[model samples]
Target chain A: MLKKVLIANRGEIALRINRACRELGIATVAIFSEPDRPSMWVKQADQAFCVGPGPVARSYLNIPNIISTALITGADAVHPGYGFLAENARFAEICADHGLTFIGPQPRVIAAMGDKATAKRVMKEAGVPITPGTDILENAEAAAAAAKKLGYPVLLKATAGGGGKGMREVRAPEALEAAFVTAQAEAEANFKDGRMYMEKLIERPRHIEVQILGDSFGNVVHLGERDCSVQKPSHQKLIEESPAPALSDRIRKSLHTMAVRACQAVGYVNAGTLEFLVSGNDVYFMEMNTRIQVEHPVTEMVYGIDLIKEQIRIASGESLGYAQNDLKPAGHAIECRINAENAENNFAPAAGTLTGVVFPGGPGIRVDTYVSTGTAIPPFYDSMLAKIVAFAATRDAAIARMERALRETSIEGVNTTVGVCLEILADKRFRAGSYAIDFLPQLMRAGVS
Target chain B: MRALASLEGLEGRVRALAAAFVQSGLVRLRLSRGADDAIEFRRRASSAAPRVPEAAVFSANGAPERLYDVIHADLVGIARFSRPAPAAGLALESDRELASVEALGIRTPVRSLGPGRIVSVLFDDGAPVEYGQPLFEIDRE
Candidate 1:
């Protein structure tokens, strides 16, 4: 077991790791940027270190500084909590090289899964259903031909890019050339990799993902699925639910089987989520997120699993204690990602100090957050402030509990997505579980934005 | 004196008093005017001093003296404190070299930023610093 773990991230996720460590009888060290000096996570940890200034590149993302902190503090393991360097294979390798265990998969697995195109190829070879896409396009010329064959309205994506960057939706054949150049340039600027992939666009697809956990003993189990179809303009997910409401039993079974097989094929260890795009009844692999996801709380709520703890146990070379039979999604769980953003605007990033806050609490309500009253929301990082999730016996009950929780929650000073989330819950389409990926955009057209 | 209800409350008061008095090397404060509840702050003199952030304490200094960090944050390595200040370490009129911190890969000079001298050392040469941690103090040099 890891005696002391260093959390190489900040905000709510940092607190999340600290809580898990405390329960497991382990010590935790928190690394923070200057702006996050007053954050609750810092004060709560066993030891705290200021890594660098406010910017991510100098602070949170500074691998050398983080590693030095772990070494100086005698931390045996490092947890890259879900963001900054969570999925960075290089960072993971550095930790290993420094004699510290990284609380995730092996460095090789992270590297293999990080490349979208290579990951697609690996899954396809494993007999998993992948979207109709070509291998890494050599250049824009290759994309042009691939798009021609894939038909119009094809999507061009950077194999190395994520969060909607280096992505272009070409509606017609003529626009493919410009879209390809722009995507390659964008990818180069952001990821320094110009390699691209072309795929047949799956329109109005429901974003569904299967959760899996594997141990070093080659044991892997599926933890059902999460419906993250609701999103904003920038592909930012706002809400997620477990058991993926309205999914057919056949589709659900297939999704679970495919996810397990995908992990087994990759020899994956530790916690991972396999993302799939479902259009109509058919599902296809989008990409594998090798890191624990933002929506993991929904799965945790539904399955009663402490994923952070599991990640630690698995990294220690322990075999999974539970098999597929021991796990099954019971009832329903829903999560709302409350961000420091203005719903009235175009979901613009709203950064300022939080002067007042009243987080909702009751039975079946869990809030993972770092900010408190008087916390400054720095502009140098991600805007997500808190993850508010609720659970109940049924999907409807969970929705009702979440809605009530959202209603009771109050935040002052900075603008939040509370109003937009309320609007989503009240919308008839959302209430009926008939909403798709376009739900947030449609709401923005008529509602807050 | 009224007893402190909790150590947390007492510690908070002591740290608050430290920030409130930058000119005085020692800080003493009472809880309220009506109550004789009072506390004195103590400093553990070492080579490296856990710096109370300059902004928090010096904001009340009233003097427009610019505070300088003797240690630059980006230099990563073990920090060693130099000899104790020559003058009871107060009211330094100019910047002066205080210590030489040498790590395996880097060497840095710890200098008194302005007209201040070493008030106290927070840690010995074997001590290590995270970003922005203070190693020494110069008081009215």
Candidate 2:
């Protein structure tokens, strides 16, 4: 097992990693920015070092400073929690070169999966079902030709696209050239990679994803699927549930098999997630997040597994200790992301001293947060307040428990998405588990229009 | 934590508290010293700790301007302030290295990000500074 872990993140995820490291008898070193030096996660870990000031570019995302801190603290491994340098392949390579274990996928695997177009090609080559998409197009003419082959309404997409940027929907031949040029320029501005591709845009597909884990010795397994259809149109997941409701057993099994196979084909290690867009019985590979996801708790609740610990163990050259057949989704679990944003005010970011926080506590309820009374919410980072998750024997019961938990929870002083999560729970479509990614944004539009 | 200043054993604690209070803008540190005697320190205008109201005789633009403190790294040893306390109302360039926090023959230069005037230097040259300690104060120019 790794002796020490350096958590290169802030907020609740850092706390989450610290707890796991303690349980595994691994000493933890926390790297904090200027504002984060006074944060709770700094005090929670075994030791902490100030990397830089509050700005993310100079601090959390500073690869050299992070590596220096790890070297100074004598950390054996670094666990980048979810954001920042979590998906940065160069950082992983730097860690490997500097004799530090990066507790995630291999650098090659990360680089291969980081680019959307490359990942699609890699997955397709591995026999995974992928949506018909063109490779990196050279110019607008190439994009037009690809669109003609792929049919109308093809997506002119960036190879490095994420968060809905660097993409445009071209529904006709005349719009393809302009859309291609705009997308290419946006891709350059956003990701510095002007590479463009064409993927047949799927309409109203349910955003379902499967969680998979792989060990060093070619052992791999899947932890079923999470229905992340309840999200904004911008691809921000608000609520996620495990054992994706109403999915047929046949399709679910296929998703699991395909996820494991795709991961194993690329020699993937540690924990990862394979996202797909499911329309009816067809499941098409969308992309793979080469890191532990924010919605990991829901899968953990249903599977009864510690993903962080497993990632550590796998990175330490240990087998999974459990086979594919040994793992099973026990019940149902749901997670509601509580962000510090006003749902009533177009989800504008709200920052203030959190006056009081009342977290729901009961059987099968978990609230992961780092906020308390007098905790200052810095405007320099993301507005995530907390993650409220609840588990039950049935999906309906899980939904009810989550609804009750959200109602019981209150974070005063700053506007929160708690009320919005409640509204989502009360919606007929959400309750019936028949919603898509457009659910939340459609709700907002209905309220306004 | 401010109440430690009252205890004879906690000598020079008030100066250290004042330095941190000035730099971090941590207002309202109320530490009870038992027997109805409590020490309270209040500061204002810090956007970070905005909930804490300003104390009396303080204004947005006052005659006696606030000074900035140069914080020490969280490293152990005998820290020595390497410069004389500049005269009050003395201006400094933003890139100027005001003083050095030297420990164990190694020096860490403390430079100001904002151009300011040195109001006063709190700690003397040969003071024993604890780890994660803040050092001097300068009024922004």
Candidate 3:
């Protein structure tokens, strides 16, 4: 058994992991940057270490400092709580090299899935539906040819990416060249890999992802699917719900089976998510995130399983404690990411001290957050301040509960997307589960007054 | 002392002042008793301190002329007896650095009370500064 675990991330995810560790009778060491020293996660941990300055590169992303803190603190394992070095292969390698268990997949698995093109290829081989596209294009001519083959309204994506960065959509031959060059340059600048690939953009598709957990022994099972279609260009997920409302039972089962097969094929171990773009009955694998997802709470609430605990168990050489038949979705759950950003201001990050915080609490409402009254929301990190998730016996009930929760929720000092989330919940398209990936952006563009 | 006010009330006052300061950049005013024994005011400075400047001199008036001359002479000596020096010997996390005296938007020279590292660069340009608030962090190196 690992005696101590160091959370190599921050915010709500870190607090989530700390809760799991505390329940499992495991000690936790929290690593925080200067601005995060006063955060709830830092105070909740058994021990805390300062890794570096406020900038992510100097602090959270400084793998060497994180590992050193873990070593100095005598932590036996490092749990990267999503983002930063969570999916970083080099960080995992360093953890293993230091004889500290990395509570995720092996470095190789992270490396394979970290590259978008390679993950797609692997999933394709595993009989997963993938968007039709070409290999990394060599030049503008190759990109143009690939776009023609894939049809217009195709997407130019970075081979090594996620988070909507380095992605461009071209609707016609006239726009293909410019989109390709711009995307390539962005890819090179962002990922240091100028490699770009073309894919058929599934118009008006819903973003659905399956949560999968496995152990080193090849046992893989999916928790369920989540609908993350309501998102802005900033890639901030506005709303997510489990059992993806419109997905039929047949499609859900198929998606789960495909997700499990993909995990088994890759010999994946630990908590991971397989993302897909769903349009009508067709589901295409987009990519696999090799870390705990930001919206894991909904699945946890509906499934009654502690995913972070499972991750720690798997990393500790323990086989999955539960079988596939034991897992069943219990209730409908929905999550709204309350970010400290001004939706009317192009989602610009809002920073200031949180003068007041009122989180809704009742049966079935779960809030995962590190903020408190008087907490200063530092501007150096992601703008997400809290996640409000609610559960009920049915989807409609859950939606209503979430709406109430949002109304009851308040955070002063920073302009947040709480108002926007309320608007989305009341949106007829969203309520009817008919919204697409472009729903939030389109609604914002129309000016939801 | 006046009756204590709610945070919202204080925040409203801060907001009003901050907005006015931002709009005008600086405002100088003097408070005096008029012939009718009413408060009179006049503008003095073009800009308010970036943040509320420290009460350098605690006298009913602002800084005394002697203290002002001392500050104008050996700026480093200000750290020794400055009304609000940096907190010393506090157990801070590794990532925390000493506040940057330069970044607080304060125009005055800031000397280290003892020793510390630069943690956050709150302000970039030399602006007016608030006193007693965190400027930076100093870890036991």
Per model, the share of native interface contacts recovered reads 0.32, 0.00, 0.00
Query: DockQ for all models, in order?
Result: 0.21, 0.09, 0.04
Q: Which runs in model 3 stand beyond 4 Å of their true positions?
A: A138-144, A158-167, A174-195, B1-141
The C-alpha stretches of model 2 lying farther than 4 A from their native spots are A136-142, A160-163, A174-178, A181-195, B1-141
Ranking by lDDT: 1, 2, 3
Q: lDDT, candidate 1, residue A315? A: 82
lDDT of 2 by residue, B6-69 (tens): 4544445655655566556666566554445444556443334222123322222224423344
Backbone clashes in model 2, listed as residue pairs: B68-B138, B116-B141
Model 1 chain A: ten consecutive residues of lowest lDDT: A440-449
Residue runs of model 1 more than 4 Å from their true location after superposition: A136-144, A158-166, A174-196, B1-77, B82-119, B138-141
Write one digit per residue (lDDT tens) for candidate 1, span B1-141: 245456557568657666655324332322333234333333433312233434223222234333333434444446665555433345556876666544334567777766665565655666667776666655552
Candidate 1 residue A237 Cα shift, in angstroms, is 0.9
Arrange candidates, best TM-score first: 1, 2, 3
Residue B105, model 3: lDDT of: 20
Q: What is the TM-score of each predicted model, taking all chains together? A: 0.84, 0.80, 0.76
Q: Candidate 2, overall lDDT?
A: 0.80
lDDT of 2 by residue, A282-394 (tens): 88998899999999999999999999999999999999988988987798999999999877787888987888689999988999898877788877888997899999999
| Candidate 1 per-residue C-alpha lDDT over A1-449 given as tens digits, one digit per residue, 9 for 90 to 100 | 87999999998999999999999999999999866887999999999988887779988998877888888788999999898999999999888888999999888889888876578789999899888878889877888889889887898989787888899999987888889999999999999998888889988999999999999888999999999999998778999999898889999999999999989999999999999999888799988888889899999988999999999999887789889999867889999999989887888999877876999999999999988898878789999999999999998889889999998888887889888988888888888887889989988988663
lDDT of every predicted structure (CA atoms): 0.82, 0.80, 0.77
Quantify how close model 1 is to the true structure by its C-alpha RMSD in Å. 6.8
Interface RMSD of every candidate? Answer: 5.3, 7.5, 14.1
lDDT of 1: 0.82
